[model samples]
Target chain A: MQTIGKLSAATGVKVPTIRYYEQVGLLPQPARTQGNQRLYDRRAVQRLSFIRHARDLGFPLDAVRELLGLADDPDRSCAAADAIARRQLHEVNARIQRLNALRDELERMLRHCACGTISECRVIEVLGSHAHCQGGHIEGADLAGD
Target chain B: MQTIGKLSAATGVKVPTIRYYEQVGLLPQPARTQGNQRLYDRRAVQRLSFIRHARDLGFPLDAVRELLGLADDPDRSCAAADAIARRQLHEVNARIQRLNALRDELERMLRHCACGTISECRVIEVLGSHAHCQGGHIEGADLAGD
Candidate 1:
């Protein structure tokens, strides 16, 4: 058994994130020492590593939870996991397409910019007038998160 | 003169988001009626529309604020706006590249998956073992937000 700090070090997940995982039921509750310090075993290490890897792969927490459930039950069909991955892949593709459109629009705006005063700036002009836009680039775009 | 609801309808910006813009100083405080209703003028409509357009192009709030400042001053050089657009383009390109890597990784995982039992699942196996990863695909990835 290792302390929570050691677990964090071993897994490369922050201490608070580990606690959060536990709170969210992603990580199982670990044992504790007499002094009430958290103690993690090898299983905890493996579980945390799996969670981190899934998160790194851009899997949402809900999908990760579903995957963890699937991982726990080895006798179950792998179809569920495959479906989840496919859905994530679709979302990623959609975001890439939207970003590409934005890129094209930005490129077009820059190309037309004279780099003169702001009054004559193509960048400002295009942004100020939606009619100048190529259209349909920003629908359902989560720009703040992007 | 128009009410906040009218402004929202005109600019396609939500009422709460308009208030948020005001709170963040992106939108100037509007005149108010004796009945305590927020009243906006034609300038407010134009300003909000500019903000929406910039946001649609995936500019961050800070960048939007800077662009708004530039727009408000017609005599200033447009170089700053040009630079901001370039920076945003660079970021979008970086994000696209990272997302492509993720897409490649996911495709690889899916292609190898045989639709067998979970015990033989490539997805679970690969996620369980980071060594199976192509490496560096997940570095600094904002998967949760992505």
Candidate 2:
């Protein structure tokens, strides 16, 4: 058995994040020592490492949960895991496509700039006039809060 | 002069978001009517549209603020606006590169799967052993709360 700090040191996951994972159902509630301190085991270390690795790869928390579920069930087919990974891949691909479009637009705008005043600036002009853009819709165009 | 609702309708920026932009100093506080209703003019409409278009291209709020300031200063050289756009382009490019690497790893992981149980699952195996991965470090590997 090790203290929560030891577990954090081992897994590189912060103490608050470990607690949050437990609250969010990602990590199971740990055992408590006589002093009421959280204690973790080797299994906890491994599990937290897995979660950390998945998150590092930019998998959303829900997807990481799904992957964890699959990991816990060794007898289950790998189909679900594949599906989750494929879905993440698709999302990444879509983001790449959108960013590429944005890059091209920015490049064109920059290339057209004659280094004049802001009134004649191609960069500002492109941003101000939607007609000058390629009309490609971004995935999350609305930054509005509910 | 137009009401806030009319401005929101014209710009496709949600009402709450417009208010947030005002709160963040991204948008100027419009004059209120005798009854205390917020009123915007044609210049506000144009300014909001410029903001909306810049945001749609995935420029961060600070970058949007800079772009707006440049737009407001017609006599200033376009160098600053060009720099901001270039920086955004660099960020977008970096994201694209990271996503591509992720895509390749996911594809490789999927390709090696033999559709076996989790004990033999390539996906889980790849995730469990970073040695099985491409050895590329992911940026922002820590998901810890500050």
Candidate 3:
């Protein structure tokens, strides 16, 4: 058995995030010692590692839950897992496309910038007036949040 | 002068988000009617629209704030705004590159799946075991959060 810190060290997942995973039902309730310290077995180690890897690959928490469910049952068909991965792939592609459009718009704004005053600044102008935009890039997508 | 709802309709910014902008100091505190209703004028409409457009283009709140500051002062050099745009472009590029790598990895996983059972599933296997990864894709970047 390993302590929560040891488990975090082993899996490279942060302590609070590990707790969050548990809270979100991604990680099962770990065994606790007599002093109330969290204890994890080898299974916890492997599960956390799987979650970390899947998260690094950009899978959402819900999708990771689905994947864990599939992993727990070895007899289930792998089609569900494949579908999840495919769905993630589609999302990644869509984000890439949207980001590319934003990049292009930024580039255009920078390219046209006269380096004068804010009143004449292409960057500010483009952002201040949507009519200055060349593309329909205003989808109201919060890039940082996403 | 218009009501908060009118401002929302004019700028296409949600009412709650406008309040959030006000709370964040992006939008100035508006005039209040005797009935305690928020009232906005033409400047609020323009400022909210500017914020909405900046947000839709994927500018983070801080960057939006900087841009708004520059817009408020018409005589400031546009270099600051240009720099911000350039920085955002760089971020968008980096994200696109990371997502492309993820896309490639996802595609590889799906391509190798044998359509068999979970015990032999390549998708689960790759996720469960990092050694199956061909690239250094585990940068610990939280894709969804980013």
**Predicted complexes: DockQ each:** 0.69, 0.53, 0.73
**Candidate 3, CAPRI quality class derived from DockQ:** medium
| Candidate of highest TM-score | 1
Show the lowest summed lDDT stretch of 10 residues, model 3 chain A.
A137-146
| lDDT tens digits by residue: candidate 2, A1-146 | 89989998887888999999999999998899999999998899888888887776768899999999999999999988988888877876766677778778788888999989999999999888788876665634432210
Off by over 4 Å in 2: A136-146, B33-35, B137-146
lDDT of 3 by residue, A35-117 (tens): 99899999999999999999889888889999999999999999999999999988888888888888888888899999999
Candidate 3 pairs with clashing backbones: none
In Å, what is the interface RMSD of model 2?
Answer: 4.2
Candidate 2 pairs with clashing backbones: none
Give lDDT tens digits, candidate 2, residues B1-146: 99999999988899999999999998889999999999999989888888888887778888899999889899999999999988888876776677677778788888999988888989887777667777664734432210
Give the C-alpha miss distance for residue B24 in model 1, angstroms.
1.6
Q: Taking candidate 1, what TM-score does its chain B reach relative to the real chain B?
A: 0.93
TM-score of model 2 (CA atoms)? 0.89
